[model samples]
Target: MTKALLKYTGEVEWTPPAIYKSSCKIDVLYFPFDQQSCNMRFGSWTYNGFQVDLKHMNQKPGSNIVPVGINLSEFYLSVEWDIIRVPAIRNEEYYPCCKEPFSDIVFNLTMRRKTLFYTVNLIIPCVGITFLTVLVYYLPADSGEKVSLCSSILVSLTVFFLLLAEIIPPTSLAVPLLGKYILFTMIIVSLSICVTVGVLNIHFRGPSTHTMGPCMRKIFLHIMPKILFMRRPPYNPGDILYREDTDGDGYIDGDYSIDSCGDIKDGSKDCLNYDCSNFKSGLHDDEHRGRASVADADNVIPRQLTPEILSAFEGVRFIAQHIKDADKDNEIVEDWKYVSMVLDRFFLCVFTAACVLGTCGIIFQAPSLYDNTAPIDIQMTRITQYGISSPPTVAPRL
Candidate 1:
């Protein structure tokens, strides 16, 4: 039973006169998180940042409390606070700003099954997207497919770069572990794409092609691995063209002739005869003929070379030998023509080296992220240190 009184003339009055009596307190509650496949818990928890957790605007008007001062005499207060979620990943360390006075309340961390989601989802996917640049090489250099692939990869790199930028805080401030690795890999991938475009330009004999200097070639050869070979298998004679080795030997059999076995061109396993002269000629040269073929015509009889034509051939061959010397002299002036090819190969080598180095650099530079320090003790000590003191007063309230 408390007596309620108002001091007008002399209604009621209580409580001894004091200089001032007020309270300033901070209350914090760390939220428990739901587990996810990703190893990291993203977002921040701070006075000012951005987050989407606990802000009950109307909860008892004070449960989510950050009371600066409570003046029971005259109520005038303002609360300045914001909440954010801090991400913590395994094998990484994170220390909260505990020495900031506040009543801490931490909900048990939601144990999530950590995964290499950064590597698996973001990194690997970016790698696959980057590898698309390599696929462009399979297309004919002169075909539109090459340009299309390059343009597409460039656009993809731009999007990925933008995404990486979004997740990163700029201003030379240290970037997050995930962002750093992602950004590094993306940079290399983007450079690889640019190099692919250059390689294609040189392959297509574009004017932008430049000679690869000897110094650069030597440097590339120095760093290149002894077994650092990444190439499509050589074109097989039997695979792309044809072979006539009846004895299963690699060389064409000497007996291979159209006149010797005509029907055996069907390539029957049981047929011991094989004519490969037709194969040496391109498929375009195999013109189909009617049943009474043009070859059977009297007017179309194959004429043997005349003595005059034979002599002309001999004379032409003899004169070509003299021209060979002239051709050699001409090549001296145009020796740099092959320099373009050398430059193209050099650019490819440099681009590949950059990619490997950049990716490894990211792997080596990733940072740790973890947090286990008890925030309660930090808050208590901070409050004690910053607590307002009474100036030699006999008694104090709060």
Candidate 2:
């Protein structure tokens, strides 16, 4: 049987299997809860004019569907998607009596991103930093670290926002839920920083910088503290506030007085009530009175300030007035410190409420995409009017 067989040829043309790589675009507007649809179109390039025809091996639409089998190792990559539909149609050349016809396949895929990664890395950190903003008020201003701590937290939040921007694509169609949260957090932190700076400025103020007016002292030291529910430190009589010497005695009274220097004695008359009845009358008595007056004046005022010549009385009066004014201003400075404390308590409550509301508003706006079976917007069609030479049109729905 082998002797009767014909001889075989040597060379044969080999055709490599066609491999297609599709270009896919991603949309991250609704990231961590976003949905995407990718298309993979298949067609033949060689033998276009009816010599080679492309066909779905199976006629049913379900039979032509290809399953996506992507398996990523990252646990944060819990994204789920599906190859939900596959549509096939014919494309014939739009020319009279032309024979170029081909089959086209368009695959539709839909996916939803899981939020595991964002919840752990983005949401938690942003939320923690937001609550931390309130701590700026809790810190004592005397430590001198309130502004520095608040500024550091502000810079940290900005760095986190920059990192978020790098991860998500730049798009304005929709803001990501986590991105909104971060933005809200950034605003709150910035406001907290401003408050911290203001509080510190108020905290460090003294009589040398600003004099607290009587109306301001009454409102801030007494009324505002009650409204803010700030606790008053236990009253210590030992730490008594300085008072004006209203009785002309060498001691101060326990009441605030606008004209505080009434204790100074002049020409044997009591300055407190401006009474001169205690002086005795006579020319010889006047001579003794003048000498006694200078000696008494040295006792009432500082000897260094009162000149021995008796003619430089104006210098002693000027020095005593300056010392009185400084004491009065020192009292006002103490009242201002109390006002700063009351303001700190007030803003602490304000920032806490703002943070809570902003966090809830930003996070809950994201839509849920689970168990959705809506029809996809993908379509595939053929050019039925071949003789008209029009552009290819979508095929009629099957």
Candidate 3:
């Protein structure tokens, strides 16, 4: 017959120091919200079945066990996990014939990672660096660092991700929310670098390097700037009015008209300061138009010639060729500058949208860790109670 104490006091008291070993495999899904259950089995090693009975010291009649003596704030690990304790029971199953049940106390530590460390060290810095990516669009393409800056930042983010990997344990179940956020931001930053490369390619193009196709010119130079509210550089009036080669001709066209007598007149200036007669006489002479008799008449009259007029006409062709070459070179440089502005405006719109969306997506996915609804004690109790149900429910399935 089992013994029952006849003179048992309603108040039960027992205390003892013991060492407990834990065989806990940590599950880190929902990392910062992760909970761990460490098992502590209490029993006498030699005493089998009826010889030893392990009882819960803190259990009360008509009520379940409530873990106490845990002050999470006092624990040295407060900087990391928000600790909690949950007490549970189960029998050890080493021998089939053993009749006594072993006391199983489970210390279920329900943890919520303290976010201030990650927030300050990882979140804020990553966000700040991501926001800085927008500035790459604002940088002057001519400064020659827009692509270089974006590349450096992309590499910096990669290094940051590598540093983060070293800090957090590798897991395939779920990535830490903060780490995921950093990774998402890194991808967007990489995309920014790609966009910058494209912008730089457009910025560096010139008439010598690449001719702006008509479609590209219409969209980038003409249409897109207004939609993006970009300010264009002031147009140089001389570029359109005095084009050196409006036609596809290899030679510069004279900005003048020749009269019936073959005399050149500057219609724009409403002036005729020089005649091409000396040039004509030197090249064609009496055969020009029907001026054979006129040239014969001029030969009969002797006229005094001066070194000044003759010298001016002698260098006329050289001076004209020099001016045309200078204008053509200037035109190519201006075309490149205009094309760069168009491309800059286009990429500014693209990169800004990417930055905003990436930041929002990364930050919004993290669950709120700092909820005020539950007290520390209640949180611990709830988590432990929840874990206790898992073994019974899952065992039948197994």
119-170 per-residue lDDT for model 1 (tens digits): 5656677767655655554455446565576677667767766775664335
TM-scores, one per candidate: 0.33, 0.52, 0.60
| Regions more than 4 Å wrong, model 3 | 1-16, 19-24, 27-77, 84-106, 170-174, 239-335, 368-370, 373-398
Candidate 2, residues 1-398: lDDT per residue as tens digits? 12222226422222224445777788665676666767766566565645554444333453544332121111121234422333443334434444566545565545556567777988788888888888888888888888788788888888988998898888776777677777888788888878888887887788778877889878888888888887677533323433235554354333432121223332211122321112222222544556434334334334322244233344445655665566556555656667778888888889888888887766655564444553222212121233223323432221
Model 3, 332: alpha-carbon shift in Å?
5.4
Cα RMSD to the true fold for all candidates: 18.7, 14.5, 10.9
Best by TM-score: 3
Better of 1 and 2 by lDDT: 2
Candidate 2: count of backbone clashes, pairs at least 3 residues apart or interchain: 1
Error of 3 at 369 (Å): 3.4
Return the TM-score for candidate 1, rounded to 2 decimals: 0.33
User: What local lDDT score does residue 155 receive in model 1, on the 0 to 100 scale?
Assistant: 77
TM-score of 3: 0.60
Which parts of model 2 are misplaced by more than 4 Å? 1-25, 38-108, 170-175, 213-219, 234-330, 369-398
